[model samples]
Target: MTTPQDPENRPPQQPYTPPQQPYTPAPPPLSDSELAGYGQQRPAVPEPKEVRLSFFLWLAGAILLVVSSALVLTQRDAALEEARRAPATPGITVEQLESTVTAILVFLVIIGVVLAALMVFFAMKARAGRNWARIALTVLGAAVFLYHLIGFSLVGLVIVLVVAAAVVTLYLPASKAYFDSVKRAG
Candidate 1:
C-alpha cells in the first residue's frame, strides 16, 4: 500500500509532537527605587538624639533667617532718613535714594524667605537619613560659616553660630553611624 515516493515504507510515519508541560505564570515586577539597591527593605535602625537635635537646629536657623529679614525691613524708614541726611553724591536725588533702598530691602526679604524654605527642605531630607542631603548641608554650612566670618554683624553672627552647631551635630559619632546604616540599607 506504499506510494511510489516511499516505495520501502509499509505505512506513513506519524507527525512528531513535544510533550506537554504544566502552566505557570511569571512573577510581576514591583516598584523600583531611583537609587540603587533601594527597593529592598532592610532592618530598622533607631535614630540617635544627635540627629534629632540637628534637625531642630536647622529649623531654628530657618526661623532666624525670616525673623532677621523682617527686623531689618522694620528699619527701612531709618535707613531712608539716614540716606537723605548723608552727604549726597552729585547725581543721586532723594527720591532715587528712597526707591533704591526700598528695592534692596524687598530683594533681601525675598532672598531670606526663599533661603528659609530651602533650609526646611534640607533639614527634612537630612533628618530622614538622606546621605546626599547631609553632604550638601555640610558644604552649605561651611560656606555660610566662611561668609559670616568675613562679616561682624549681629545677624550674621547668630546664623553662623546656629549653622556651626548643626554641622557639628551632623558629624557627631552617633549621626555618622546613623548615616552609615542608612547607606548600607540602601
Candidate 2:
C-alpha cells in the first residue's frame, strides 16, 4: 500500500475485443443439376444457323425472280416493235413471245414470293422456339433443292445443294428437341 504509481508500471490497457455477432453462413453456389433443371445450358436454346440459311435462300430466290421478270418486260416491248414492222408471221408473233415470257415470269415471281414468305414465317417461328418450325423449314428447303435442280445447271445446282444441306444439318433433332423443351416451358 506504500508503493507509488509509475507510468510504466500501470496495468497495460485490456486488448480490444469486438462484441460477438450471430454466426451466418453464405448460401452455396448452384450445382450443374440445379442449372440443368432451369434450362441454363447453352445448347438448350435454338441456334440461329438455320434461320440465317433460310433468309439467304429467300433473298436469292427473290432476286432471281425479280431479275428474270424485268428482263422479260424489257424485251417484250422490243419484240412488239419488231412484230409491228412485219406484215405477218404465221407461227411466231410478238404477242406470243410477250405472253409466253409474261406467263413464265409471273409464275416464277409468284412462286418466289410464296417461298420467301414461308422462309420469313419459319424464321420467326424458329426464333420463337417452335420445334415444328424446324421440320417445316427442312421441308421447304428440300423443295428449294428440287426447284433449283430443275432451274439451275451444274454449278448452281451444287450451290443450292450445299445450302440445303447446311439448313438441314443445322436444324437437327438435337436442336429441335431443345426448342421443344423451350416451347413446353412457356
Candidate 3:
C-alpha cells in the first residue's frame, strides 16, 4: 500500500563510483650521503701560507725564549758581582742579597720556559684553524710587548717584534678567510 513517493517504493539504489585521482610519482628516498648520521666530508681548503709562516714565527719565538732564559741564567754570577759592588742596603748582608737575586733569576727562568711552551701550543692550535687559539696568541703577544715595554732590552726588542709580526700575519685577509672557512666546515 506504499505510494511511489515513499522510501520503500524508490528504485533499487546503485553503488557509489568515486572519481579517479590524477597520477603523481613518489619522491625518491634520501641517499646515504644526505644522512647527517653518516660523517659529512669537509671541503678541502688549502691552508694559507701566512698561517704557516705565523706558526713558524711562534715556534722561533718559543725557541728564542728558552735559549735566552738559559743565557740569562749563565750571567747570574756577573749579576751577583754587580750587586755586591753596588752600595749595599743598610742591613742586608751580601749573602742575603745573593740568595734573593738567585731566587728571582730562577723564578724568571721557570716563567720563561712555561711561556715558551704555551706559545708553541697556542701556535699549533691556531694553525689548525682555531680562532680562539689565534686570539689567545694575540693576548700573549701583547703581554710580551708590555713586558718588553717595561724592560726595554735588545733581546726583548727582538722577541716582541717577532711575536708582533706573527700576530699580524694571523689577521691578514687570506688568513682570516681561511680560518672562517674552517670554522664553517667544522
Candidate 4:
C-alpha cells in the first residue's frame, strides 16, 4: 500500500553498479609480418572432390573443342569437295567460292579456340572456389549442351554429355560447401 511519494515508507536504495565481466582489451593491429603470415595461411577448407572433377571435366571440354577445331581444319579437302559439288552461282568464280569457304572455316576455328580458352579460364577460376565462376561455367555448360542437342550430331551429343556431367558435378552438395567456405573466408 506504500507509494514512491511516501519517502518515510521507501526502502533503502543501493548505488548503481555495472555487471562484472572479465576485462578484454581490443586486439592490437596486425604488424606487416603478421599480415603476411595471414596471407600465407593455408585455406581451412579443402576443395571438394566434386569441384575438382568438375574442373577436370571442363578442361576436357576445352580439349575437345581444340581437337574438333583441329579436325575441321584438317578436313579442308572434304569441305572443299562438298563446296565444289554445289551448283555454282552465276557471279561467283570457283576461286572465289573456295576462298569464301576457307575464310568461313578459319573464322569458325578461331571462335572455337576462343571458346576453348574461356572454358579453361572458367575452369581455373571455379577450381579456385569462385562462386561467380562456377555459376558462369554452369550457365555456359547448359548453353553448350542445348546448342549441341539442337544440332544433333555424334560429336555434339558427346559434348552435350560432357557439359551436362560438369554442370551436375559443379552443383553437388560438396561443391556448394566448398564455394560457401571460400565465400566465408574471403
TM-score of each: 0.70, 0.49, 0.71, 0.70
Every candidate's lDDT:
0.79, 0.60, 0.85, 0.80
Least lDDT summed over 10 consecutive residues: which range in candidate 1? Answer: 34-43
lDDT of 2 by residue, 89-118 (tens): 578766676676567656755665676567
Q: Using alpha carbons, what is the TM-score of model 4?
A: 0.70
Clash count for candidate 2 is 0
Write out the backbone clash pairs for model 1: none
Q: In terms of TM-score, which candidate is strongest?
A: 3
Instruction: Please provide, for model 4 over 17-128, each residue's C-alpha lDDT reduced to its tens digit, 9 standing for 90 to 100.
Output: 9999999999999999777768543455788899889888888888887777666777678788988899877899878988988897787678668777888898888888
Poorest lDDT segment (10 consecutive residues) of candidate 3: 36-45
Clashes of 1: 0
Which consecutive 10 residues in model 2 have the weakest lDDT in total? 64-73
Per-residue C-alpha lDDT of model 1 across residues 1-186, encoded as one tens digit per residue = 954665576577788989889998996765555355465343357668998899999899889878877876897998788878888889997788989989988887787677777778887888878878788788877765664454256987899799889988999999999989987876
* Better candidate number, 2 or 4, judged by TM-score: 4
lDDT tens digits by residue: candidate 3, 1-186: 955688787799998999999999998987876775466333346679999999999999888878777767887898898888888699998789989879978887787788789899999888888899999999999876775564456888889889989999999999999889989878
**RMSD, one per candidate, in order:** 9.1, 15.5, 12.8, 12.1
Output the TM-score of candidate 1.
0.70
Q: Per TM-score, what order, best first?
A: 3, 4, 1, 2
Models sorted by lDDT, best on top: 3, 4, 1, 2
